[model samples]
Target: MIKFLVLCLIFLFLPFQAATRKQILIGEINHELKNLSALKIVVFKPTISEETEYASMVIQAFRNYFVKKLAFDLKDRENISIEVILITDKEGKGQIIEQKEDQGQGTVFFGKSKQEIKSSFFNKEGIQIYPTRSSSLKENLELPSLLEAQSDSVLFLLDFDNTIVLRDDQYRGQGEHLKPLEYKIKELLGISYPKILPEETSINIGDKAPNILLEGRKLSDYQGMILVLTFYPAAYSGIFDTSLITKRISEHHLSMMSCAMHITSFDGLSSKIGGLGVGYFAVSESTPEILANWKEVLETYHIQYINNPDYSLSKSFGSYNSNGYNKRVCVIIDKKGYDILPISIMINDYKLGKKKEIQEIVEKLMINI
Candidate 1:
């Protein structure tokens, strides 16, 4: 009878012990972050083993959330830094086993924030807890406005079973749960969310190049020469550097055509090119602010500009995106006015800083020209 009573006591005490251990682990994580003053974003993943596939999914979700929803270029680490921590359970103790940095690429569509960015973790009950802030403190004192809380950093706690999965029986990582977390982070950063428009069908290889009006002439007018159409958001948007691309084109002596999403002046024409013209898609009915941002680029590279107030030109080529800007792509049209090179090939080559492949394609097409 005494043994039976002791067994019941042990079972009741087990849950309490587990809860205590969890709280201890949470304390340790918070202490670790407090010691690291430089880390702006910290992600904590707790696991029973070394495997971190679910943790990776969480990171990818954050990347997609920020890039797709907020338009934040995660690659701009100059303004933000992230650290991912892996906490492993060994013999009932939580230990931080690994740490690494991530770039999180995408551009900031809204204005940049000077506030320190942070992440929050969900508790066992799925309630988000900001580790740096005290829970007992008054709400106003604990949760200050984003601009007022410049020094505070957020931490994220991810558990494979509880935080990542929707059901205990399911294993897939659903990103829908991350929306609230993303909005909280955005609010903390003091940045407004911008509406993203839908993307249109893009131009494909072998399709006849759209005969859109370019200045006074049509796209077919350049049928005798191979045309390279490079589409970008705008000049110096930090999304893509058109100046570097133009320099590469000039060095390779490839005939080039550039497109933007705003009004631009095209007075400079380079004599070195087989053909050169800049086309722009208007963002609004009224003339948007003209920076003449590319005028220097034009004079320096001898590139010409053409204005197309119509967004159809961008849509026809599959360069239009929801951000009222052109998707970064380089489409190659053969001298016969048929798209000979896919945008993927050109974009991939440019990203790798290898213009040789594109130059080779242009040379081969020039043979037929």
Candidate 2:
């Protein structure tokens, strides 16, 4: 009876003991491999879960985000790779398993429980483990430690919304949720850029204007001609009514010099002003959808449309917004290719239908030029 009771106790405690043993093995492996130069990202794939597809989507989204963010510069960093594991509740539930027999080399593990895996990847020296609730995962994820672990080439165990099991694509979330993590990774990799530039140092008047590619032609190709560059939000946002502005500006014969003048419009078909010296050109980001939508209007106006798809032109001119639109500002470039305006002149507001302000500004600038 005593032996039978002891055996029963061992059976009850066997799972716990195995779990503890796996935890120790993971710690030892992490300690042994923390200083290696190869960095691997381990994602656990659940063998039995109704949300398996959702988890796969999340993984793909993460992979896509990482590739889109880092692929351009990843060629220089050959030490990074992603590995997926088919993890089950029994054998590898919360343990670090090696990919090969070569110890201290290759992929690591992403434990099922947060407490089971104490990350040595982000710590300067030795592993630091913290107990955390799944809801407060982001707060307790030790982002600062991640930033500090810049020198260590180690694997990352990413948990999406506190669980490896996601319900659906919508529940998987978007890249915005992972943006903070992405930014930290980029910073650690030394490839992060500032979100916003200082106004004083950004593009300003009197500075040599940055060159722009309009369609196949470079802005430099239009040198010696006074360029009236209009940056607008979209084809027809009502903030800057292209039709009215074009008509107003064309009425003044701003392009009478045959110097290749450009005007952007939303509703009107491209048409040449009769015997007018003004050359009407419209510039926009070149995309198939935009081109298709604006085809009829562009044809009606007879306007030369230039493609600025990346918005590099608008951004260089300080007219771009982070929300993927250009500000309603008109930039006047002199014949010498310098931004001649001391201040951005406000055009018509569609709400008020005012047109005189832009007319006056353009007329005045033309006279001075």
TM-score versus the correct structure, for each prediction: 0.35, 0.33
Runs off by more than 4 Å, candidate 1: 1-197, 239-291, 297-299, 337-354
Q: Give all candidate RMSDs, comma-separated.
A: 16.9, 20.5
Model 2: weakest 10-residue lDDT segment is 118-127
Q: Report every candidate's CA lDDT.
A: 0.36, 0.35
Stretches of candidate 2 exceeding 4 Å from the true structure: 1-207, 236-281, 286-289, 297-302, 336-354, 361-369
Per-residue C-alpha lDDT of model 1 across residues 1-369, encoded as one tens digit per residue: 999999999999999876533311233445554444232222322331113223323433343333222223334334433233433211212332332232222221212222211111111111122323333322412222222111122234323211211111121122222323433444445544333357776656656666766546676675466656544444322102334445645575343333221112111111323443322222211112111222322222333333333445556677665645555555566654344322323341122233345456655665665
- Deviation from native of the Cα of residue 213 in model 2, angstroms: 2.6
Error of 2 at 202 (Å): 5.6
